[model samples]
Target: MIIRSALTRSLIPEFLTGAGRNQREIASALSSSRREFLRNTAGLVLGSTLSGASPFLRGESVRKKRKVIVVTFGGGARDQETFAPEGQENIPHLLNELVPQSSFFTHVSNQGILGHYVATASLTTGVYETLNNFSAVAPEHPTVFEYFRKDLKRPASDAWVVAPSNGFNRIGESECRSYGPGTGATVILPKHLLAAATSGGAADFDHLLRDNYENPLYTPQLGGGEFELQQLDGILRLSVADFMAHARTLSSPDELSIYIAKRLMQQEAPSLLWITMHDIDVAHSGAYSLYIEGIRRTDRLCTELWNAVQANPEYAGNTTLFILPDFGRDSDYDAGGNGFQHHRTGDVASRTTWMMALGAGVREGVIFNDPMQSIDLVPSLGAIMGFSPAQSQGKPIKDLL
Candidate 1:
């Protein structure tokens, strides 16, 4: 399924050919008016691994057919509580179990909005989107998922975004006129889905707390077409009982995401998956102990995710894993903002994070000390998966390519 350079331009769909060519031509020549432009491109819905025996461990030529999983240490974590010398104790699994086996980047900067929704949008799109940080809106540009799906002609199940934040419901898609929902990722927000399933009176304080963190929006139900039903039946059938069990575990959002991730990889072996964890944002409570506990929990969940990848034969030896924080927190004593309480100060601590890449096609035991932008992840992923994200502003990470 890897559409390498050998796939000639003539074979690519008109919507996916050339660098930004599709969007530009459609925007300019297709319609004379704005409303007409949208109507004209309405049909262009971006309509959008694993396993196997021991062929990979046997060093067979299965490298070209790799899958990718991106685990974001989201909700803005600082190095002080996760990766620095003093913070090592809080993430023993990462430092002791995962770091040594991966290629680590010491300095990754996010030079854009520090809010969770906006920051993650920037990360996913490789563009610094300036949208309202708290709104339930999609990015203005096409996501990496859109690029991969449109080019590969993969099913919607092949690209996914497993998030806990309701504000990110649209993160799987975009508002871009050319490539929209038709080619967006299949988004799953665990907490929101659970809330939607739970009866109002039966919901407890824990459920209420989650609801407050991310209020689920209700839309009128619309019957799905035959194609939609066929494509989504399996995911829609996820058991409420199983979801509740995981929701009660340590770091509800993070753990639940990992649990669902395991199931997704097992059932579909998606070509691209993005998982975002948010417990660490509890630091905003300004409680040092709680923040550290969140860090420790995040560390554990990360290890669990890595373990899932290794244990799932569909993903085991032929998957690449990228883990990094969306952004950082203010320095402890900075006059701008208190430590671990704010990421809006634009301080080095708030903007600088780290990245780790492991598994297939990743160089082991290597450390990249040079500074790199956070947006670089999108294109680097493109290079690995064999497609160019036509609208991405960031260049691929040369080392990874």
Candidate 2:
């Protein structure tokens, strides 16, 4: 008899056995084996074909149903600028208009290294980073995505990350990639398609087919056309060939990404979806007037996304939208006059961020006064989605629930 390897055994915990006279010994044994089991179970749990077989795949009863949409206001904006009444007119649409109808967190703050990756990691994983750098690793705890996907037995591809730029390329090992129990596939910035199209590369169906053949995993689904395959390849080139054929009809890259997200929602919308808008970040190249214009465009994008969610049958009435920045720029009070230029040094303004929530299960027009950290988002999201916290460092905001 050939026993399964340790790695294999680690993934499937149901195969383990324990014997003890009392509860403590049994519990200890189970704990030791649990991590290994979950690790070994990844392949089967995240396998594309087996997605529908999971118990949690069954849609929730109408009364218990809820959806979660997390939007990173990538590239930070100051509270004084966005929500604080001091500069309320700067972001009039978001502040005076949106805040009144949605729940606002007046005391909310981000307590990380005051960097993009660090704050985003804290927001999703509910832990502070020891370092404030780009390549920083996400904490080794289950994220809001993992809690919903694994504990709830939802499909692996149900979770989504739609970024206009490379905003969410590092959500986590498990959250960013298709692995482990309840891990879902991610969609990254596929700017390559635009590059290819603009660079005079062939955009015809034949060229895409050839590319697919060279990589068998890229083979298009029966009904999905070549353009769809190209779009899927642009973001996730492996393990998602089934979505390619439908990509042809998308008019633009943004539209293509949103279409794909909507498709995933209809197929089996993972309980958790993260969307990042980065058009404004590109506008910060020393053009003050252009930067303000970018802000307006970002506002419109938010409105468009909200409209899409409302109009889309799959997400309407069932989703919760949480939007906030990843980090903020330097204070204009600096002597060197590096206003709105960078976020290098840690400052009071740089660490400050904002949050807003609307939709199912969230109290409308409520404002939370207690200070909350970005790490708190994961647990709060988990509680709202009917799951227990999974070894997170932050506490859930009871006010949000």
Q: Rate the local accuracy (lDDT) of all candidates.
A: 0.66, 0.51
Give the alpha carbon lDDT tens digit for every residue of 56-171 in model 1: 23222453457899988967676545543345567878766777677676567778888887889899999988988767677998899988888767788788888767667778
lDDT of 2 by residue, 1-20 (tens): 11246443331122212222
Which pairs of residues clash in candidate 1, taking residues 3 or more apart in a chain or in different chains? 45-182, 46-182, 46-183, 47-182, 47-183, 50-314, 51-313, 51-314
Q: Give model 1's TM-score versus the native structure.
A: 0.78
| RMSD value for candidate 1 | 15.9
What TM-score against the true fold does each predicted structure earn? 0.78, 0.65
Lowest summed lDDT over 10 consecutive residues: which window, candidate 2? 42-51
| Candidate 2 segments whose C-alpha is farther than 4 A from its true place | 1-64, 84-92, 130-132, 136-140, 175-182, 196-268, 335-337
Q: Which segments of model 1 are wrong by more than 4 Å? A: 1-64, 201-233, 249-251
